[model samples]
Target: MTPYTPPTQDQLLAISVNAGIEELTQSEKFAHAESDLVEAIVEGVGQFAAGEFAPLNRIGDLEGAKLENGVVRLPDGFKEAYDAYVEQGWNAIASPEEFGGQGLPFTLSCNVLENLGAANMAFNLLPMLSVGAIEALEHHGSKDQQTKYLPDLVSGKWSGTMNLTEPAAGSDVGALRSTAVPIEEGEHAGKYKIAGQKIYITWGEHELAENIIHLVLARLPDAPKGSRGISLFLVPKYHVNDDGSLGNRNDLRCVSLEHKLGINASPTCVMSYGDNDECIGELVGQENRGLLAMFTMMNNARINVGNQGAHIAERATQQALYYAMDRVQSARAGAPDKTPVAIIEHPDVRRMILRMKALTEGVRALLYYCAGQVDRGTIGDGDAKNRAEILVPLVKAWGTDTGVEVTGIGIQIHGGMGFVEETGAAQHWRDSRIAPIYEGTNGIQAADLVTRKLGIEGGEAMIALFDEIARDAAEQPTLLALAKDCAHIVRWMRDEASLDDRLAGSVPFCTMAAVAVAGWQLLKQDKAVSAGAAPALAESKPVSVRFFLDHIVPEAHGLKASAIAGADLLYTLPSDKLVAG
Candidate 1:
């Protein structure tokens, strides 16, 4: 199993100072205490993650989650670990202080999530989902809904889940068949009786918390077709009393959990709401405005999922690096000793390690940068907000796709043992596989990048982002030409190509943008390090940036060409005939 290393104090400090996080927190009266508080929080989270959560990663994977008698029992130690997590107040690190949370900057929370996710992703999913639920309620929930739900949710006395996917409606949310009927009278007036099945619900039915709050997306009886007519509901597993005590059971149950290839410990549940037509839910926002509200949570989840990619990649990189150092293989080139040397000495293995290092560090920087941008957005910075929106899909898609790639490489580093499940390299690869598929598939993300985000504010966001990257690259002699190459591809996609052409190469284009953004961030770090700040961590900045420029950046031009190639060849071969033997 891989050892989880918390972000170096130097790295975290650099990110905070560069991202204006200090300024943001200073505005909140944490100016004097910012350095000390950030350090304490980071150290506290790292210790909790390594001591409590890391040990259980393997056990959770082995035992997975068990469902019996309509209840979900987490793998042994999971509940205890979750209790430790709650006790440490890790759940409320970035939540608003008014709601019993610490109200720390999102960037700091992201660092905590990275450490925890690397330690044990399956266990971490519980709190990750809860954060999204808190965002939805904090932004869009009714006053009563917030008062009744926010406290326990914020306090970690309760857990939460987002119910969006159905068997028939995974990515195409508009096709969901879940329905809700309005309640006419009594204490529950304006509420709805929700009835439908929701599939792939993460932490949907766990026994670790006093209550489980489900944020469900359902259509009203007289609602129109598709997503526009949909509404959001806050449905608790156990109904609550006027005084906040738990009451009768709601009409919902986890029918089953999926046996997955990776992250088996995080239950992917098949939930049936209102089998007896007794499931009641309060609207989260105005009727017919549910998608708007759900997006508040979904967008947060996208970045978080991107961080998952970074986390898994970081874990995989650590394992691979360790394996390379310990794994003895063929002799090094020109070495007099015939005895085998560590695989780390092998040129190709070193290359692979560097690739993993570059990707992990690059994505980590990008994710943290996005987190900082989010904090800026929260404080009402319009440009920062738009940039954050533009970067979400990139971070989610590229970050995750990179995780899958890096983990596979980690497996490769193990040689024979990597193929065996016992070594744990394979587990990382398996766990990372789902990231690109969920939280909006990478393909959907690409399409969004091409069609939705590229056109935001009449393309001002895209323009500003390109300029931002290019400007930074211009200052760094090593990255100037590469940045120009990236700008050329982006411009080609925007000015010359049709939507179909854009989608054809969306994946590559997205990758190009992510690498460029990451490269820019790394150079920024390099500059900081050049000033003798975090000198040790800074030394690697140039190497990672060089590797990214030489290896990863070259793919952009080709991807742009492929994107402009159009869809003619793709459709020319009939799908049925093409697949025939």
Candidate 2:
């Protein structure tokens, strides 16, 4: 399992700029990321990924993590690789500088995580969850809590987990039944004891680090029912002293690990809290406001899940392309009869490869653009913040769903080799299946797009996005042709007579909106390239953008029609009518 050596600077410069490293380097927005810092981080991740991480991916899956005597042990090499990650300062990419973080731009964090995911997704779960925990603490933890926990978490000296789902509550947190009772008279009077079970917790219990901090959501006594009653707590595997050193072990224990379809190397645990009546957790933020506090982390985790999709898709696409180039088959129409040609020479194969490339690059562009917006919101003043906030969900929903589709195509390109586990194409396909399911399902994402994101500011945000696309199309003739297609769709969507049509096509309409928005960003890159920014990059921006607009964007019409058609066809049939009974 040799790690793919990343393209050199000059070689990278020659690749397509729709979402290449060269363009990322040249973008004006990334100017804040110091050149030395970027180079060091990228090189470190590249080497670690190729040398240590990638080799262990399959091995980890085969061996898997194990639970013994209430202690969860990670697969071999995981501890060493994790230590290397911490030593390289990879975990601090997006944390605050004052709290032991490097305070780098979110875009850089996205880039680093992409490589880590590509190299080994299962092992990367530890840091991913740690960062999510760090974000939750940064946004809601008290100054004392931040001072005590931020350093260790950011430094990767400890790991973290978000315990949300339960046996009864999966997508709906409102149904959660975990409870927290305050201690009366003790050394930890302000702390509460958490008691309940949480399911589907990733990195829930592992011996990868010194400690594990669980961000548990539970109900307090005398509180209201449902979501309003829930509160967040910082429950640790090993209690921490006032000075932040590890203390006595807590009562939290991993009851069992889930048998998952993919990401088998990353242990998903069933954890029980206060099983021994000694689990003390400090409350985060106000009681009954835990849901609000958890949203910050959920949103962050959702975006990362989307990136998981994007990163895996990129890896799969690369694998497919490599196989297509090397696996020779029957000669094509123009070739000599007895000779064999690479699969890449066939028209259908080329179409599939091109489709994979276009979709992967398109999603990459969307995610990177969204990453830039996040950076701006964090560092740029005023309006930049507003813009970045608007783009978050779109990036999350579109990026991840596209990842699933692209990875599936990656398998298609590999043919029968993909179905066999040995080729690893099936692994990508299996691993990527969870992206859309977790971090909020794709259907939920679509609902949010329609109900919350699209209607923000009374639909002004969406209108503005449409206007920006129109303006871009107007300025560039090549884009104008594609924009014209988008404009037609938009016009139809807005027409009073087309309301039913639009509603019927809501899903497709949303899909079109995604492509239109993605194309808008791609066009900006085209403008940048035309202006001599990253001049050495290949000029596939127009071709790729056009391909999406021409072939993919039209799905909007059908989707919009279906969305507007109402749920009649779906819901009208009674249960009895639907079945033989």
Candidate 3:
């Protein structure tokens, strides 16, 4: 098997350049940083990921996490690995300095996330979720809440979990039955007793941190119906005392751990809160406004999910490439020799490898670029903020879908051996599967893109994005025609298509947009190559871009056609008839 290697300096630089990081660094808001600083950080993170985290990937898959009694015990070495991660100060690399963070750009942080995620996804999720919690608290938490929680959460001493799912609620968060009732009298009069059960909670219970901080979504006594009645709360596993010491345990416990198809090392818990009516939780932002604050955390998580997609794809690609080169098979089509040759020499194997390579690099380019927009948005760039908002769904949906496709291809490249668990190829597929379902299902993401994002600011963001795509195609021959097709689709959604039609096409539109953005990023790479700056291992960039243009670009056009076709055909059949065998 081929050994996993960290991304090189040139690859990092090329990605950064394509992501517009250098341009952002020159702006007044980001002028404090330099390209060299980011490069160094990427190199450092790569080393840490390759050494401390990569070795744990298979170990985590094999050992997995176990639930014994009521406690969730991590697989062996997980605790030590997590400790090493925290001790290295990686948890605060992108957090604000006021909260004891390094205050670095999220673009750089995303690079770190990609490396760590590729190394060991289950382990990487711990700190990744914490970072999202920190963002939520920093943006919406009260001053007192910030002082008490930000430091520990930012420093990774306390891990965090987002509790938005329930067996009854799932994606329809408004259907949640969790309740938070205010205590009118007591030492904690301002707090509320939270009573509810949440399932599919990732890292809901873990031993890696001093405490597990849960950002829960529940309804108050006087709250309205549906989502409008929901509120956000901070419920810690172990209560904090007046002096910052640990208090009695909260009334919450992990009732059970889910047995899953992948990411077995990460504990997915079914948590019961306030079983004894003692689960006290403090309001995060305002009463009945929990969804607003929780959206912050969820939005952050969506981007990371995209990164996870890219990460898993990269890992699968490495494994597949290695196997293809090393696994000797039948002789080549035109070879004179009768001796068997490596599978990599075969045309079909080469096509599969190219497909994997193109999708992996393309998605990585899209995700990093999305992160860069987030950085600009953080700096108060309204246009960039709008761009980021619209791109979030596409990144999350397309990236994960690509991950699944690429990983499946990886399995196929390995032939029957890939189906066996021992080769580790199948695990990538299992791990990648969850990303599409994470944050929100890809179907939901597509719906959001068509409904909420396109109509924002009078469609100004969508308009600007499409305009940029058109302009981008002028220099890249592959995109020139697709860009024109994208423009017509945008118009169709805006004027020709009804709301139902838009919804029907939303998934395709989002997929189309993702491919377009990826093509744009790859075009930047093509330009970089043309300019005489290239990586030592970048011989594949040109070919990968070409493969994407030839094989993937037409799929975008087909999706556009489907989107334009509307939902009429989908509803033609009666519901009962559709279900008939």
Candidate 4:
């Protein structure tokens, strides 16, 4: 049996209640994606993901992506699955209509990727990055660039890679030493010769797509130092003729692949550009503005990365629940009929399952809310965009952390069998461990939340959201208290905190804010039960929300002391001394 089962009902309810799907469809931009159409899309993608991607999950992890003859090869069946993914138009659902997309709501696309990630996290990376590329180009690329690239990229006939990290530059985009020199003369006079070594290039090399697009960041000769000097370039694996036909191979190739903790089925390549001094690339935008353009892509990726939390957590929770219900173990603690019983009846096991359910559901609701904000923001709701920007770090950081926790809980429910790979239980945990570390680590997210986002519109928007949540959670005073506390801390952070203090307390404050925000969404779902907002899930939704408010949201209160703790204590123990202990 496959480890994943798409939570179709839960997803739809989250979209309905959390994403405000009805309100979203009222916007003229997304008017075509009516309730019936949205339902059909979600169901179709769910079935497709289950049939095409789920069975391949274990196979992909077992066989993994391979590098042979300097070419990266994905697991068998990947090409066929990818073909189905493209042929079905799943890749272009939310892309712009001008570029061959259906022009649906962002939430619809989010649902599609969520299903794919749940089915096979590794397999979805290919299309996820491609969508990110489409976003970047749609915003910043020149008309020629968009015309030449958007259709294929949106169609999933071509793939994309963001080449940012090098050995010397992981998160510090400015520290990169890659160079791009102007050609000055030729058929491609405006283009430049790029030379660089990029590591951690996801899907950098693969045969599934007709072409691979590399968005490379490099420094122009004699440009200003640091990040201001860097520029973004569109470097393709194969040159495209003016007629849009594939031409000769470019001077880039995958030199090596990394052996990673998980997602082994998705190739992480060490890409070398201009090895033969012939790699040519067109500038993506104005010179030295690469970081700004790339941020467009990064911001989108961050949200999806956060949603991966919900994706993996849902699959893991389902697997754990199934195993607990069927795996016969010790007798119930108090029941008189005390022969061996299913572990589902055990208190401890019950606790784990409930916690997993609560965390996943809360995180899912929050991300879905964020998705709705995107649609609202796109349709001229500037306030909604501001709200989304503030919540993104929370989703990216806290959501991913929840993925790791819930997946680990899933493994715990499986017990000894969980530790063994044969049960496919541990793989969820293993695959989930990377979420918090990538797409701008959870630590970076915290720092951004406290230092940058806390100051948005002088923190008024954030405080207002807190005020709303607090009002809604009046009966659940625990959540109300946490919401009020988070709003107060936002004021302190914006007005009085030192940079060091903000950095030191960032993580805890991040956790505190995320929990409060999540409580806000969970409570919304809970209130919707009898209101007919999410009728399909009325029974289970209330239970999950109650569990979250009572058990999980309390963590916010516990983190307050740490959240406000100043920087002094963190520096008291020197780095070496701290490590020595």
What TM value does model 3 have? 0.97
Q: Clashing pairs in model 4?
A: none
For model 3, where is the 10-residue window of minimal lDDT? Answer: 1-10
In terms of lDDT, which candidate is strongest?
Answer: 4
On residues 320-396, what C-alpha lDDT tens digit does candidate 1 reach at each position? Answer: 99889998888989989888999999999999999998888888878888888888888788998988898899899
Cα lDDT, all candidates: 0.84, 0.74, 0.86, 0.90
lDDT of 3 at 51: 86
Ranking by lDDT: 4, 3, 1, 2
How many residue pairs collide in each prediction? 0, 17, 1, 0
All models, RMSD in angstroms: 1.7, 3.7, 1.5, 1.1
Return the candidate ranking by TM-score, descending. 4, 3, 1, 2
Specify the highest-TM-score model's number: 4
lDDT of 3 by residue, 411-448 (tens): 99999999998898998998889999979999999999
